[model samples]
Each structure stands twice: as structure tokens, then as C-alpha cells.
Target: MENKVVKVIIGILVVSVVFGTLFFWFTPVKDGKKQLDQIKMNNNYLILLIQVINRVLKLAILTTMKDLKIKLNQLKFQIVLN
Candidate 1:
């Protein structure tokens, strides 16, 4: 269902972000200063990307929760009838 699909998408995004952060932080590099400078230069872009991803994650979770609530209510109503 749509709820399952949304949950899967959220899981995938969360996993990717975790691995990406680990790789970004722990991966070996040749020049520390140069790497630092590069990261500093791209900081704004990184912040923007993180913000966009955060918004997407929030929206996905909210919709999934809403769908789940609707499904739960339907089930409850069915049980009451039975």
C-alpha cells in the first residue's frame, strides 16, 4: 500500500544519510587543509541540501502517519461491526 511504500522510502533515505555521513567524516584524504578548505567553501551548498532532504523526510513521514491513522480507523470500524 501507499503507507508501506512511504515507509520504505523513508527507511532508504535514512540509511543513505547514515552511510553518507560516516563516509564523509571517516574517509581518508590526502590533504587535510585542502579538504577542510573545500568543505568550508561548499558549506552553504551542503546546508541547503540537508535542509531540502529534511523537508522531504518530514513530509514523507507525515503523510505515512496520516495514511496509517486512516487505515487503523477503518480496521477499528470493521471490528466494531463484526
Candidate 2:
């Protein structure tokens, strides 16, 4: 039962990530740039924000992958134990 819940959660997370990446990547570039520019006048701050955003994106992807791996491992264990 727990394994099934994990699978469902992982499935939802994967779908969310796919849709999120697509949404963010294909979003109008001009608006993004404009907002980034408005947030900070200094180049350094803009660079920092960009870096943070990139890191966050990477971390999110990594986290989702890790969750999936754990769920798969649990299922494998259950299969072996059965």
C-alpha cells in the first residue's frame, strides 16, 4: 500500500517536472528578461539571480530523480522479499 502511494507521488512529480520545464523553457523570453532586469540594476545581482535559478532548477530535477530511484528500490525490495 505504501509502495503504491510512493509510485503515485512519483508519477505526479514526474509529470509536474515535465510540464514545468516545458512551461519555463518555452515561456516568452522577453518577459523573463524584462523581469530579471527590473529586479536588479546591477549586473552582479542579475548574475546572482540567474545562478540561483539555475541551481534551483538543477536541485529540483535531482530531487525528483532521487525520489524515483528510492521508489524503484523499494519496489525491487518488495519483489525480492515476496
Candidate 3:
């Protein structure tokens, strides 16, 4: 269930990134200063989005590692009993 949720979130993020890139490229700005400012704002948002994705990935990795550790300990306990 968690894996499915993560995949959905990642899919949505990828789609949004593509849409934002297209919007930014096609947007028309008559004022040079305004365009520069808008581009900078978009860049900041992109950076933030990237950071969020990285954090999610890190969380998934940590969770998997914890689960593996638990299973390894369980196996070791069983081996010792037998």
C-alpha cells in the first residue's frame, strides 16, 4: 500500500514537472524585467519540488532498511533456536 502511494505521488510529480516546463516555455512576457522575475520564481519552485522528491525517496529507503533489519534479526533468532 505504501509502495503504491509512493508510485502515485512520483507519477503526479513527474506530470506536474512536465506541465510546468511547457507552461513556462510557452508563456509570453512583454516586459523583460517581469519575465526574468517570473523565471526566477519558477526556478525556486522547481528546486523545492526536487527537494521534496528527494526527501520522499530517502524515507522509502530508510523504511526498507528497517524492515530488512527486522527480518534479519528474526531469521537469526530462528536459527539459534533450531
Please name the candidate that would achieve the greatest lDDT relative to the true structure: 3
Clashing pairs in 2: none
Model 3, range 3-65, lDDT digits (tens) per residue? 677777888888988898788767888999989988997898789889988987887777778
| C-alpha positional error of residue 50 in candidate 3 after TM-score superposition, expressed in Å | 1.1
The C-alpha stretches of model 2 lying farther than 4 A from their native spots are 1-42
Candidate 2: what lDDT? 0.63
Per-candidate clashes come to 0, 0, 0
lDDT of each: 0.74, 0.63, 0.84
Best by TM-score: 3
Across 1-82, the per-residue lDDT of candidate 2 in tens digits comes to: 4446555655666575567556544555457777576444444544655575566556667777888999899999999999
Better of 2 and 3 by lDDT: 3
Over 5-66, each residue of candidate 1 has an lDDT whose tens digit, in order, gives 76776677677767766666666668989789757745654575588678777887788789
Clashes of 3: 0
Instruction: For candidate 1, give the lDDT of residue 63.
Output: 84
